[model samples]
Target: MRNITVEEFRASCAAAQQLEIVERKGMGHPDSICDAVMDNISVRLSEEYLQEFGEILHHNIDKCLLVAGEVTGIFGGGMVTHPMLLVIGDRATFSAEGKDIDVNSIAVDTAGRWFDENLRFVEPEFLDYQVELKPGSAELTDIFRRKEKMLGSNDTSAAVGYAPLSFTEKMVLDTEKYLNSPDFKEKYPESGEDIKVMGVRKDSDLDLTVAMPVVDRFLDSEEHYFRVKEDLTDAINTFIADYVEENKVSMDVTFSLNNLDMPGRGMNGIYTTVTGTSAEDADCGQVGRGNRVNGIIPLNRPVSSEAAAGKNPVSHVGKIYNALSHRIADRIYTAVPDVEEAYVWLLSDIGAPIDRPKVAAAQIIMKKGSVESVQDEVTEVIDRELENIGEFTMELARGMVPLY
Candidate 1:
């Protein structure tokens, strides 16, 4: 029997609460880089496997690490003293039916392609890659050879997803995206992609502090750096102000960029980078240290601890449950009436059918109705999603679903 539960949430949701905090690590951040690169490698491997073999094989390439390289630069110029090191590893099916797949080439090629597409200044040559993906163990590889089309859940794990993002949450997510947008970059090429945004909301007001590094090549002098900083700050503030007013997004939203800069400290005070990311010199990165499946990190709400990126889309509970929980939560919030917010939790048992979770639970914060009133509708939504979980897994295998 499938375990399912629904209950009324007595306390206020994050949106209703007066104080809320949310965070987002932009794509160029070291941790995000690792997540993106590893996830890309997994997707490529899945595609290759499906093409060569008739089925998507067993694999999980979630492990990845970034070691910071050395770099030094002055205004108008900088050079990488040493290239960044990217170590990617995990498990995969290297050989099947006496045929071998080149996992190493796929990983390195995928990682290189991801860098070219995402980070403007960081080239493939600027980083060295070490792929440590080995074949899965005998017991684990046997799971994929089952007679049934549906794979069993490979791990016991729990994931939570909430719907109806609060205004503060929206601001934090969208602002980082805006900073990384192509138009923003064209207007201010000095802006780096290694940006992080933190939002603290009190009641109806929000204060957003953004840390976006500057490209050393674009900066000519200390004065020029300050000017660029001021220009970028004013531009972002203006955009946010207009965005809130035009879209009716939120109240009293404020934006500040690079608050750590000091006037005369030379390179010490400024947040400038040879490349657009800190992975070139200052900080390292790893998988799962970036965003959740929903993108923003909403501190007030329960979230998935699993890093969805790079895990096998078929049977890995960490990746599947984490992504599905959000879809279920969103569906509930949209389908049910008078529901202020919906949170969906899915727990998986190892060796259980992937379609049937160990526990499918929903905790509802009502807007105008009691949990009893919406109970049947919420339960129906969860049941429907769980039944259709295989389709979701297919979508994941096709790279149609966004995991990061």
Candidate 2:
């Protein structure tokens, strides 16, 4: 059988515009018309409206079409406004403006019920939000950008409704959990199945739990794309807000991660104690009396012997260190109060008689919860801990050093 020309079909279509034409196999179909209209709308629709309808399509496409009838009484009937073309076999061919477009047939179930049951358009409320991350904060910005990448991927399904968490943000929490656990493997047996956790050790800062949402796996369709996009956006925003809150504690304090042993005046000798004092044989003649205080010092105090040696105005005064400690304390206090116990450590070179006493140390302070209230106690302790050292101030200080 020879194929009929589109012109002939159009002439026939014009003759029986109202005829309940029996849709023929390999002939133009109604669904094909709808599909074409939908595709055109998707591409030409304003981004604003696209987002709006896209969201609706994500969860309610069926209702959008069919539900309109319930309230308006204007669908599926003689008004000819909401056109319903007949379907035959698995193909629906229709002629429009002398051109033929074929659409794959929808199933009876989909055509009769599901297709139009979910696309009801309703008056909706719109909400607006502005991101609050600092503009120049690279880490926060990077995290945000990463989220955008994940959300904007071609996977429309994940892009549509899925959201993901940042690897960096999640790492911090995972590190905390792992460090606090007595037997991480036992506590988290599934660790064996995690390819990322192979060699993790105790007290390590490495965050083995970092993961980004794999939106690629589900981006096969428009519906999934919308779903993933919503989810990814929400996840990123939530994580950022929490991170910012935790780090806000150290806003005013600064800490140094570098060596802190040099006096402003000159290089002091090794921080060794000498029994003999100045020309006068004073009671300070203890043999083991080395000026260099060798061990750890409280992070709240100056740790360099040079500080005490030159009485260098700021020597051993704990100005910077105390400021840092207080900042941490402030954050923790604000976030979590009533910490029953806290531990802090500092390393120092107390004095300088010997050639060199390197001043380097880490603070390891722990505090017990002081309050009887459960939520209050947990929050208070966390706040205090965050205030003390959670902010990246120590990291920020290196870049701000004066150019010598």
Candidate 3:
């Protein structure tokens, strides 16, 4: 039997607050790009390992870096003066029983496929010569030798998650999804996936700042760039207006698109890039630099710093516990009708069984009344979740859930 504890405490819910801020970096953002690439590689490696070795071997390919390339462009077209560089770092089991697994080939191919499938302007050929893989350090690789079958915790870490998202949080998350949705992409073909949605709530008013990259190939001139910006702004505000009205939330809403425009250059000076992402010429990226496990950065709320992507799903508490915490909170929040918000914290000791966490604390804010009424039910849910956490590895390997 696993020993886990759940407790309820008093705390104000974000929805009841007067001010809030939330941020989400979309899939094409450089840091998110790095995250997606590493995640894909890890998932692929896990699949291959399971097929050959009967289970995933120890691997943590989380330390990935994206070095920006040089490019220059007009409204209609651009050329890659220097190719973007991707470095795949961290340790993995590349060979076993004298049989070799081509880890480099797996990583490079995954990078190409991810870019080609995810980013509209980036072609796989452009990245073929630029991606490089570095082998894992001997010291870190030694850590995997201790556990082969039922894996133990890789590190002692804490993870936090919450549920029943606030109005602003939903707005921020939805905005990013809406922009990246196929329907929105079809309507605004010029828009790139490198979208960032920032939300601020002051009193009853909500303000949103969205940064979307415009593909140079889609814009013919400065006039067309401005037109595309206008269309996107209109589409987003329209969506916000509908959402606010449907939710019956009496709030004022405003939308701003890339305010970094120069005074004279206008919309052309906004966040346009050659390859539909700032990574082409301006920005660099690293894994874990963007969004948390919940996909939103709530500046005023409690959050864990653990980067869930690329960590070994079998035993890394940083990845499994974070996902478990979120699922637990969501389950409790859904089961308890009066619970306005639910927050869960989980801690693990290195080499310990994952099902038996060191600490499992839950905090809930009721809409009206005390936790005594729902305490037992919430505890049951947490216990059940912890017992079933072992199944999460397969879920992750199958890509049923996102680590970040």
Best by lDDT: 1
TM-score ranking from best to worst? 1, 3, 2
Candidate 2 residue lDDT tens string, 259-284: 22233321121110010001011111
Give TM per candidate: 0.98, 0.14, 0.94
Which prediction has the highest TM-score against the true structure?
1
Candidate 3 all-Cα RMSD: 2.2
lDDT of predicted model 3: 0.82
* Model 3 worst lDDT window (10 residues): 125-134
Model 2 ranges off by over 4 Å: 1-171, 174-211, 215-219, 246-404
In candidate 2, residue 403 scores what lDDT? 8
Pairs of residues clashing in candidate 1: none
Prediction 2 TM-score vs. true = 0.14
Clashes of each: 0, 86, 0
* Model 1 TM-score (2 dp): 0.98
Candidate 1, residues 1-404: lDDT per residue as tens digits? Answer: 46789998778988779899999999899998888888788888889888898788899999999999989877887998899999989899988877899999989988999999988988667899887888898777888988576899889999998898887888889899989999998888889999999999989888999999999999878888999888988888898888788767548888777889998999889989989999998899999988888888888988889999999999998999999999999999999999989888999999889888888999999988689988989999999998888889879877788776
Q: Give the range of the ten consecutive residues with the poorest summed lDDT in model 1.
A: 247-256
Error of 2 at 41 (Å): 57
lDDT (Cα) of model 1: 0.88
